[model samples]
Target: MTEYSEISARLAALSDDQLTVVLQAATAGRPAFWAVRAALDEMAGVGNVTPGTDVSPATAAPGVHDQVTGGGVSGQVGAASTVPAVPVHPAGIPDAPAPGGYSSGGVPTFESVRDKVEQRFGTAQGMGELDRQTPAGRSADEQWEAREKAARERLDRIRKSMHDNDTP
Candidate 1:
């Protein structure tokens, strides 16, 4: 007999409990087998076979109907359709409007740039607040110095270990 026929004959011989276990194993490995598992679970429930051990199938995969009708996936399905668009400024232009209605030939002054940065990031108070929040108050230069010192200390420790080994 062919493989299909042999498999069918074997399946036909399995008790309802054995079939339920096989269906659970198959569905657990692959979500696509969920539908078949669900049907088997319902059948098992009605037949009162392995009633205590019955496992319900996972929810169905999201479908086109879910997307259009907004019914299937709960919170994941019903989010707002469109996000707010980002405001755009003209090319080679800053996002802020020109100060005093005066354009300085499109070249922003250092003070203007500093003012803009401070406006967005706040004054020295902001920098102080950020520094206080961080574990170390050191700036970029201080951090680099700390890293260099740590590397040198590590190298010294390794050299000491090697010298001790050689002397012994």
Candidate 2:
């Protein structure tokens, strides 16, 4: 196989246990993990408390609930059914949670981090009328910019330290 094809096949063979270790390392303090963690925290705060529902994406065991839910083997011994099962949400749990938690209505669609940052900061231009109206909003924007700059600088320093300590 060519180098790219060999790499692709190797990646395809990675088990879920192996992938979880890679994912945790990659997302340690990043925004994507932060968002997912926030969602999980919201779920916990609401005390969903179902036997299978409390499983975290990181440590969740595959097929543990399958036995109880009748996700058992079909007529063909090893073949999984081609039909996709519809997800059933429990009562009182919101279909889509907003940034912090549950909202009044409407399903929350996934937005790009850039889009969310722009929306939060009013840089998406016409998105936030109220943000453009007030002096306090302008102050908050300035504070956000300053904090973002500091975070970037901190990351730069950490990267530099890693590079400097690398073995030749």
Candidate 3:
């Protein structure tokens, strides 16, 4: 059979998705299926066919225009214009910190780190009492050891603060 018939048969056999891809490729200038269509028309002795009625002789193709004198069927072309610049502020307003930093009211400050730590693990003195081997104490030996280590660290920080103040 002829190449046209073979191509037509292949197109007929294409799946819907394949047909869509073919149509998109044809619409874009890449594969140029219109060139093949033109060739087929020439083989059938039909000259170039222009869609719809012709316009003024001075006009170029449908969307295309004569760029020589910067004037076309559309309009005259000029230098590309740019968008206006936005005003700048020197002292930028600070944005509210993220949700984790504030309560629902949109304020940004957080509780002191020591306050947060104490909230999570009671007071350092309370933790030291829990670490004691009293009958009422609830923590395991390892847990008590860990809590004692934390309490000692907190005490060291307090002592360092006292020493630094005395130096002045």
lDDT of each: 0.59, 0.55, 0.54
Question: What is candidate 3's lDDT per residue for 76-120, written digit by digit as tens?
Answer: 376332212222223465544445766445664556454577676
Better of 2 and 3 by TM-score: 2
Ranking by TM-score: 2, 1, 3
Winner on TM-score (1 vs 2): 2
Best by lDDT: 1
Winner by lDDT between candidate 3 and candidate 1: 1
Off by over 4 Å in 1: 42-168
lDDT of 1 by residue, 1-168 (tens): 254466666666655555454555446656778678777766545344564453656756546633333221223555542222222234676544357533445767667777788787777778878886676865665888899999999999999999999984
Candidate 2 runs further than 4 Å off: 1-127
| Model 3 CA deviation exceeding 4 Å by range | 1-93, 102-114, 120-123, 133-168
lDDT order, best first, reads 1, 2, 3
TM of each candidate vs. truth: 0.24, 0.25, 0.19
lDDT of 2 at 136: 86
Candidate 2, 93-166: lDDT as tens digits: 65544564334465444454546776767755654667757898888888999999999999999999999999
Which candidate should be chosen as best, given TM-score against the real structure? 2
